[model samples]
Target chain A: MATLSINSVRKSFGAVEVLNNIDIEVEDGGFLVLLGPSGCGKSTLLAIIAGLENSSGGDILIGDKNVNDVHPKDRNIAMVFQSYALYPTMPVRRNIGFGLEMRKVAPKDREAAVQRAAELLQIEHLLDRKPGQLSGGQRQRVAMGRAIVRNPDLFLFDEPLSNLDAKLRVEMRTEIKRLHDRLGTTTVYVTHDQVEALTLGTKVAVMKGGVIQQLADPETIYDRPANMFVAGFIGSPTMNFLKGTLEQGDGGLVLRHAAGTLALAGLQQDVAGFVGREVTAGIRPEMLDSGDGPASLTGVVDVVEPTGPDTMVIASVGGQLITARLGPKDRPRPGEPLTLTVDTTAINLFDPVSGNRI
Target chain B: MAATRSRSKLLWDVISYVVLVGLAFIAIAPIVWTFLTSLKFEEDIVTRTMQYIPSRITFENYVKLWNQSGYPVLVINSLIVTTTTVLLCLLTGTVAAYAFSRFQFKGRTQLMLGYLVVRMFPAVLMIIPLFIIMRQVGLLDSTIGLAIAYTSFLLPLFVWMLKGFFDAAPKELESAARIDGTTRLGAMFMVVIPIARNGLLATCVFVAIAAWNEFLFALMLTTSQGSRTWPVGLQLMVGEFQLPWGMLAAGGMISILPVIVLFAIVQRAMVAGLTAGAVKG
Candidate 1:
C-alpha cells in the first residue's frame, strides 16, 4: 500500500543505452503497467525498480524514501518473474514461507502467512508438491502465492501471464486483476501485450526505443495517443494510415490521397490551417462502415476475414489497402465493389514528416 | 513389400547389435580380465598362455597384499586425501562459482580467464615447482599436504565446471529469493545451492575421481606409505623381471571399486548435470 515513483531514470550497459530519461509514478494501490515490445527496456525498468539492476542515473522512490542505493531485500518489493521462478527443490509450502523465514519472522506467523496466501490463491492442496509436480498454471499461482505471502510494499510482475497458453493467460490475467483488486497493493507490471495493458492497468506507459512514448490511462492512450507510435501500437487490427495532402475542395477541406478524395466531414473545424500540406490520416478499422451514405469512400474489396462477431474487410482505395471491421453479415467478398463510409470525427491527423498528431 | 521392409529393419538391427556388442566387449574385457587375474593364484597368473578362468580361485593374493605390504596404508591415505580434496574443492568451488555466476564485479572476466588458464596448464608442468614448494614448506610426505596440493590443482576445474552450472541456473530464482528478503548470499545458499544439487554431486564425484587416480604429483611429492596414494603404491608391486601380477591386479581392483560404486549411485545426476548448462528451459 505504498506509492512507487521513478524519476528521470536512465540506464546503460557499457555504451548501449537501455532506458533513457524515464519518469513514472504509481499512486498508492494503483496498477501501473509498462507496455512495450521486446527489447524496449520495460523489463530493465522493472528490474531497476526491483533493485535487481542498477540504473545509470535517476532516483527510485518507494513510499517517499529514495531506494536507488537500497538492496533488493531492503527495498521490500516482491516480484513474480515471467518464468514463475519457484524454487524447484522446495515444496510449495517452503516456497511460500521462504520470504518470511528470510525476514526472521516467527515460525507460527510464517505458517499462518503461508496458509493465508495458499487459501487466497486457492493452492492449499498443492502445498506439499514441488514446482516440477505442478502444472504451469499451478506453478504460476504458487509463484504469485510466494509473492503475496511476503506482503511487501510493492508487487512487480514481469509478463507474468506470457508463459501460459492463450486461455490460461486470459484466466490468469483475470485472476491477477482480481488479486490486485483484493490486495490493493501498489503494483508495477511489465508486459509486451497491449491487451494486458489495456485490461489490467490503471495507468499504462507505452515505450519504444528505450524511451517513454506516452503514459496515460487506457482509454486516453487508445483514443488520443500522444504520437503516431502510441496510436499505432495501442490498437488491434491497427489503425490504417493514408499518406495524403489536405486541400480545400468544393465545399470544405478534403484529404487527397492517391486513389480518391475523402471529404473531411467534421475534421475541417479542427484541421482548417493544414490546407495543401501533406499529412497522414489515421482511421481505425472499426470506423469504416459499409453502408453508402454521406461521406462515403468507394473501394474494391480485397479480402474478408470473419472472426465470428464481426468481419474484417480489406478494401483497396486509390491502390491503398484499407481495412474495415464491419458486421459479419454485411461483409463484401473479394473483388466486390463496396462503399465504406468514413467516420471523420474519430479520424486522427499526423504530420507526415514528423509523425506528430496534428 | 511389408515383409521385405521388416526383413531389412531386422537386418539393420542385427548389424547395430553386432557393432555395439563388439565395442562393449572391447571396453569390458580389460576390466573383466583384471578382476579374474586378481582372483587367480600367483603361480597361475604367470602362465605363458592366457587362461580366462583359473583352476584354483583364491583370495590369498588380496589378503597377502593387504597385510604384507603398505597397500592398506596406501588405500587409507588415498581415501583421506581424495575425500579431503573433494570436500575442500567443493567448498571453494561453490563460493567462487556463485560469485562468478551471480555478480557483476570488476575484473570478473579477467578472473574467469585466469581460472581457465590455471585449468589449461598441464599437471606435469606444475609437478616440479609444486614439489619444490612442498619440500620448502616441509609438506613432502604428508597426506594432508597431498590433499592441499590436489585441491589447488583441482579447484580451478571444479570452479570452472560449477560456474557453468550456476550460470545456467536462472537468475530470476535468486532475484525472487532476494526480493523475498533474503540477502544475496542467503539467496545463493538457500535457493541456488538446492537447485544445483545435481551439479554439486556431479562436481564432487569428478573431483573425487581426479584425486583418486592422481599419480604424477603423488609420485613426485610423497616418499613413503604415510602419503603414498593408491596409484603410486600399486606401482611398487612391480619388479624389474617378475611382476606380482595378482597382487597388483588386486590393488588396482580395490582402487577402482569405490569410484565405480560412486558413479553408479550418481549416474543420472552426473549425466543430467553435465548437460544442464547447454539449454535454458
Candidate 2:
C-alpha cells in the first residue's frame, strides 16, 4: 500500500551505537526483510520502522510522509510480534477487532472486518476463544489476523514465526507469504533466520553490527553476496571460504593455495588489481561435485553426514574445513582423499584483508 | 540397595507430612480456638477448668457483642476505612507500578528505593509525625484521614507487589496495542491492566487486610466511636480489670469474617495470577 524509505537512520544507546547510519527502501507492495543474528539491530530497525522506538537520527518516510516524529498509532502500522502479543484476556474476535474499536469504528463494520480476517486465516471457529485457549499455531494465526484486519499501509512482523516449532514455523511462513500476496501490503519483516529471509523477502537487507551488509533480492544475495559476512551468513551448511592467493594464470585468474589451483572463470566483478594478492574464494556447498577434472580440488575427508537426499562431505583442504554437498550416493569415507569439481563460474572472490567481495 | 532407597523415600515423605501437618495446625489452631470461644457460654469461659470446648453452645456472646456495644459502628468504620484505603492505594499504586515497570526515566531506581525506604521505617515511628500532620490538616479523627494515613504506609507495599505483576505482563503486548491504534495510556488500560487484573485484585485484598487490622494509628488518631476501627474498638473493650473473653472472641471472629470471605472469593484467581508469568505465551 505504501513505500517505506529509511534514510540515514542512526540509533545509539549512550556511547555505543546500535544502528549506524542505515538506509533502506521498500517499494510499494514489496516485502523487505531485515535479517541478522541477535544483537545485530534487525529488531531495532523494525521497531524504528514501526515507530515504537525513535531513531537517534534520520527520516523514515512511509508513502512520502516523514514519520520520524509520528506516534506508532498515528503512523497507521500493525505489528505481529514473535510472541503473537494477542491480548490475553480478549477473545479472538475482539483481538482482531481491537484496532477498529480503538478507532471507534461502527460495531457492524468492525465485526465484518474481523469476520473477513478470521475467515481468511481459517480461524472463524476460534473467534469466541481466548488466546490462552489457542494452540501455538492457532495463536500465530490470531496474531496475523490481528494485523491483516487493521489493513494498515505497512505490515510489520518482528520474527513472528520464531515462537513456533519447526514444522509450524514453515507452515506459518507459507501462510504469511500467502497473506502478503493476497493483501499486497508493503511489509517489513525482521528475523534472524536466513531461510525466512530468503523465502519471504522481496528485498533482503542482510545486516551485521547495525549496518546493512547487502541489500538485494534473495537470489543475488545468495549467489553473489556483497562481502564475506553476508556470503557466510545467508546459506545453510554455510559457504566455504578457501584462503588462497589470486594469481594471473594462462587462461584468466586462478587461486593458488595449499591444496591446488582453482581456475576462477566468468567472474562478473573486476579483480585485476588483486592479482598475486591473497583473496578468499567463497564456494557454496552444493557447487562442489565429485570429479577428476583439471579444476578439481582434493582434500582428506574429515567428516561425512548423510541427510536423506544429500550427504555433506566436510573435508580438510589446506588445513581448512570445507563442506561439500554431494549426492546421497557419493558418500566418501572419513580419512579418504576426496576430489571435488568446483563450480568455477559461481565462485565468489573476496579481499582477505577487507573481507569485501572483489 | 533398591529396598533401602524405597525405605528412605517413604521416611522422607513421612517426615515432610509431619512437618507440614505441624505447620498447618500451628496456623489453624488459633482461629479454631477463637471460633470455639465465641460459641462458649460465659460460665464455661470463666470457669477455673481449661475447657477446650463449650459445655453449652450459645449465641449469647455474639448477640451481646452485636447489640450491647458500639461494635457494629466500629465494623462499619473499619469497612469504610479499608475500602477507602484499598481504593486509594490501587488508584495511586497501579500507575506508580506501571510507570516503574515500563519507563526508564532518570532517578527511577532511586525513586523505587525511596518507596522501599518509606516501608523500612517502623509504623510506630510514623505515628507522631502523621498525628501532627493530620491534626494540622483537621483530619485526625475521620475515616478518610485514617484511610489516607493507611495509604501512606500501605501504598509502597502495594506498589512493590503490583510492580512485580506489571513487570510480568509482556511489554510487547503494549507495543502491539500501540501499533493497533491505542495511545500509551489507552494501551495500558486495554491490554496491560486486563492482563494484570487478577494480580490487582490480590493486591487490593492484601492492602484491605492490612488496613482492616491496623491499630496503632487508629488508636492514636481517633477520639470518637464514629471514627475508631474494629481493632481499636476491640482493644478499648478490654477494660482495665474485665477481660470479657467471650465478647473478645466474638469480636475477633467478626473482624475476620470479611477477610475469610474475600480469600474464599479470590483464592483461585490469586493462585492463577501468581503462576501466570511462569511460562511464555
Candidate 3:
C-alpha cells in the first residue's frame, strides 16, 4: 500500500478544461472517495491518477516517485470499472488470473492466486463459468476478484456498485468495505452516490464544476460542509436554505426571513460582520423537533410524509416553505398549524451571494 | 378475444413463411440448376428445351474436363492466391482496425476517411495502373503477385468491417486488462481479439470470396499455366469456334465448391460479425 499525492493537476481537452488546478493527497491505507455529480471531472481525476488518462499539467506522486509519464501497466494499480468490464471470452478463473499471468507468474502460483481470490469472494463454484453466464452480482464479484488478485499499490474503483440492484448494491457495498478492511490497500474511489461516499470513504472530497468544494472526513463533511455546494451535495433530502438577513434584535441576533424570524443564540458571534446583510440559513431536515420548546417557530403544515421511523413535514409560513424531519408520532396533517423547535446550534450560515460559509 | 387474436397471429405466421420460402427458392434455384447442368451430357445441355432432371446422370464431363483442361492447376492457383490474400488482409486489417478503435492520435479521423475513400473507388478503375505496376515488378502471371495486389484492394474492406467489430467491443474490457498488467498491445490481443472472433472469421470469409471471384485483375495479370487462376482458366474454356458448355460448367462448379464449403463452416460467425455495430441485439 502506498499514499498518492496529486499536485495542482489540470486536464484540458483542446481549450475546454475538464479539471482545473486540483490538488489532493491520500494517506497510506486510506479510503479516499471523489464525490460529484456527472460531468464534474471526478472520473477524469481518477483516470488521471490511474495513468489511464494523462493530465495536461501536474505531478502524480505514488508513494514518493512521480508517475506522470508512467504507463498504466507499470503504475501497478488495479481499477474496477463501473461496468464490471470482465473478459467475456475467458472463464472466471482466467479472468482472475490474467494479471498474474501477464506479470509472468508461474502457472501453479497463478492458479493458487485465482483460487484464493475466488474463495475470498465466495465464488469458487463460478471459476469455470464465463462472464456472460454469471448474474450481475456474480459479475461484480468476479470483477473485484480480478482486481484483488493483483495486489496492486492502489485500488481505483469507478462506481463499482452502481450497476447492481438496490439490495445487491448494499450487499456489495458491505462486501467491498469488508474487503478493504481486510486488505487495507490505499484506494481512490469515484461515485456520484453520496451515501456510498459517506459509507465507504475515510476521506470524502466533494466536488463541483471541476473544483473541490470540500475535502474532509465523512462526519466532518456532513456536519461542517465548507460551502453551500458541499452542504447541498453531501446530504440526502438536502439541507433547506432559507434566504434571510442577520440582524441584532432583542437579547441577541436573529435571522429575519420573509416568512418569519429564527433567533440565533451562538451563531451571532461568528457572523457579526454579516449583520443586516442577506445570508442563507442552512438547517438539516433532522435538526427540527416537533415538541414545543424555548426555540420554536410557528408555521402551517403544507405536506406530511410518514416514513415509519420518522415523519417529513413541509411547512409554509408567510408564503415560504421549509421541510423539517420530526418523529412519526408528531406528524402534523396538511393545513394544520404547528410549532416546530429549530436546533439553533446545528444551523449553518452562508453568504447568500458567494455561497461561502459565514 | 384470445381465440381471434391467436387466429390472426397464425395467419400472419403463414403469410411470413410463404414470402420467405418464395424468396429462398428464387435464391437457391439457379445454384441447383447450375450443379445439375454440370453433370449433364454436352448434347443434353445445348438442346433448346429445358430438362428438369436428366434420365441418366454422368460424371464423364467432370473427368473429361479435369483430364483435358488445366483445371487442376487453375484450382490450385486460385486456392493459393485467395488463401494468401485472405490471410494477409486479416493480419494487416485487424491491427489497423484495433489502432483506429483504441487510439486518439492526431489525424485519426482523416486517416479513417482516407481508408473509406480507398474502398469507395471502383476496383476496375485501379486494374490498369495495378497491371502496369505488377508487370514492371516482373510479378505478372504469379500467384504471389496476384495475392499482394488483392491485399491492397481487400485490406480497406477488412479494416472497415473489423473496425466496426472492434468498436462494438467495450473499451473497458481492454482498459481492465491493461490495469491487470498487460501492455496495451497485449491487452488487445488477449482481450479484444478473442471477444471479436466472430468478426475476424466473417472478415476472412469476405476477403476470400472477393479474391476467389476476382476476374479482371486475374485475367490481365496472369498469362501462362504457371500463374493462371481458375476464373481466368474457366473463361478461356469458351473457345472461338464453339463454347465447351459441359467443361465450362464443370470448371465453374469446381471453382464455387470451396466458397460453399467455407460459408457452411462459418455461416453463423459470418452473420454475427457482418452485422456488428448495426444493432445492439
Candidate 4:
C-alpha cells in the first residue's frame, strides 16, 4: 500500500481548463473517494493521479516518490474502469494475469497468483471463458481480479460499479468494500455516486466546477457541509433551503418568512452579525418530524412518494417547497395540511449571496 | 384466402429462384466458357456458332501452357508480386491505421483526408510517375518493382479499411495494456491487432486480389518474360496475327483459382468478427 498526495495540481486542455489547483492526499490504505457530478474534473484528477494524463502544473507523489515523470506502468497502480475494459480476446485467466506477465513474472508464479485471485473473486470456473461470454457482474469481478492480482501500491477505480443494474450495483458495491477491507491497499475511487462515496470512502472530496468544494469524512460532509452546493449535492431527497430574514424576536432570534417564523434561540452558530439580513436555512428531510404541536409549522402537501422504508411528502411552507421523509404509515394526501416540527440544531445556515455556510 | 396466399407464395418463390438462377448463370458464364474452351480442341473454338459443348476434349492446351508458353513462370511472378504487396500493406498499414483511429495528433485528420484523396484518383493516373520512379531506382522489369507499384495503390485502401476496424475496437483495451506494463506499440500489436485480425485478413484478401488482377501497371512496368504477370502474359498470347484462345483460357482459370480459395477460407472469420461484440452495450 502507498500514500497518494496531490500538491496543488492543475490541468488544462489548451484553453479549456479541466482541473484547477486540485489538492488531496490519502494515507496508506485509506480509501479516498472523489465524488462529483459530470464535468466536475473528478475523473481528470484520478487520471492525473494514475499518471495517465500529465498535470499542467505542480506535483504528484505516490508512496512518497514524485511520479510526474513516471509512466503509468511504472507507477505500480492498477485501475478498474467504468466499462470494465477487460481484454476481449483473452480468457479470464490471461486477463487477470496480464500485468504479472508484462512485469515478467515467471509463468508458474503468474499461474498461482491468477488461481488465488480467481478463487478470491469466485471466478475459478470462468478462467477459460472469454470476456464476451461472461455476464456484466462477472466481467466486473474479472476486472477487479486484474487489478488485485498485481498487488500494486495503489488501486484506482473509475466509477467501476456504475454500469451494473441497481440491484447488482448494490451487491458489487458491498463486494468492493469487502475487497478493500481485505486488501487494505491505498485506493482512490472516482464516482458521481454519493451512496458509494458515503459507504466506501474513508475520506470523501466533493468536487464541482474544477474545484474541491469540501474534503472531509462522509459523516462530517453530510452533517456540516462547507457551502450550499455541498449541502444540496450530498443528500438524497435533498435539503430544503428556506429563504427568510433573520430577526431578533422578543424571545430570542427567529427566522421570519412567508411560512410561520422559525425559532432559533439556542442555535450553536453565532448570528449576531446579520440579525436583520436574509439567510437561507438548510434542513434535512428526516429532521422535519410530523407533528401538530404549537412549535410545528403547517404546510400543504404537494406530492407523496413512497420509497418502501419511508414516504416522502413534498409540501409548500410559506410558498417554498420542502420534502419530509416521514414514516411510511404517515402517507399524507396531496393538498392536505401537514404539520412539521423542525430540528433547530440541524438547521444549516448559509449566506444568500455567497452560498457560504455561517 | 389463406390457401390462395400460399399458392401465390409458391409462385413468388419459383419466380425468385428462376431470377436468382439466371443471375448466377450470367455471373459464372465467362468462367464456364473459359474452362470449356480450355478443354476444347483449337478447331472447336474457331467455329461460327458459339460451341456450348465440344464433341472431343483434349488436355493438350493445359500441357502446352504449363510447358512451352512460359505460363508457369508468369503465374509464379503474379503470385510473388501479389503476396508481397498484401504482406507489405497488412504489416505497415495496420499500424498507420491504428494511429489514425486512436491518436489525436495534429494534422491526423488532414493526413487521413490526404490518403483518401490519393485513393480517389485512378491508379492509371499514377502510372507515369510510378514507372519513372521504378526506372530511376533501376527496378524496372522486376517482380519487386511490380509489387512496389501495387503497394502504393493498395496501401491507402488497406489503411482506410483497417482504420474502421481499429476504431471499432475500443481504445480502453490499449490503455489497459499500457497500465499492465506494455509499450504503446507492443500493446497495439499484441492486443489491438489480434482483436482486429479479421478485418486485417479481409483487407489482405482485397489487396492481394487487386494486385493479382492488375493489368495496367503490370503491363507497362514489366515487359520481360521473367517478370510478366498472368494477365499481361494472357493478353500477349492474343497475338496481333492469330489468337491462342485455348492456352489463354487455361491461364485465366489459373489466375482466379487462388483468390477463390482465399475467399472461402476468410468468409467465416469476417462473419464471426462482426457478430462478436468487441464492446458490449
* Candidate with best DockQ: 3
In candidate 2, stretches whose alpha carbon ends up further than 4 angstroms from where it belongs are B1-20, B278-281
Docking class of 1: high
Residue B132's C-alpha lDDT in candidate 4?
Answer: 95
Which residue pairs clash within candidate 2?
none
Q: lDDT for each of the candidates?
A: 0.90, 0.92, 0.89, 0.90
Error of 2 at A262 (Å): 2.0
Cα displacement (angstroms), candidate 1, residue A95, comes to: 1.5
| lDDT pick, better of 3 and 4 | 4
TM-score of each: 0.94, 0.96, 0.96, 0.95
TM-score of 2: 0.96
The TM-score obtained for chain B of candidate 3 when compared with the true chain B: 0.90
**DockQ for every prediction shown:** 0.85, 0.85, 0.86, 0.74
Q: Which pairs of residues collide in candidate 4? A: A259-A318
> For model 4, what is the error of residue A170's alpha carbon versus the real structure, in angstroms, after optimal superposition?
1.0
TM-score of chain B of each: 0.91, 0.97, 0.90, 0.91
lDDT of 4 by residue, B6-36 (tens): 9999999999999999999999998999999
Between candidates 1 and 2, name the one with more favorable lDDT: 2
For model 1, how does the per-residue alpha-carbon lDDT over A112-179 read when each residue is reduced to its tens digit?
99999999999999999989999999999999998888888999999999889999999999999999
Cα deviation at A347, candidate 3, in Å, is 0.8
Summarize candidate 3's per-residue lDDT along A1-358 as a digit string, tens digits. Answer: 8999999999999988889899999999999999999999999999999888899998999999899999898998999999999998889999899889989999999999899999999999999999999999999999999999989899999999899999999999999999999999999999999999999999999988888998999998888788999889878678988888889899788889886788887652288788999998888988888867656677899998888888889998566777888887975789989888888888889998899888
What fraction of the reference interface contacts is present in each model, in order? 0.95, 0.93, 0.93, 0.72
The regions of model 4 sitting more than 4 angstroms off are: A293-295, B1-25, B272-281
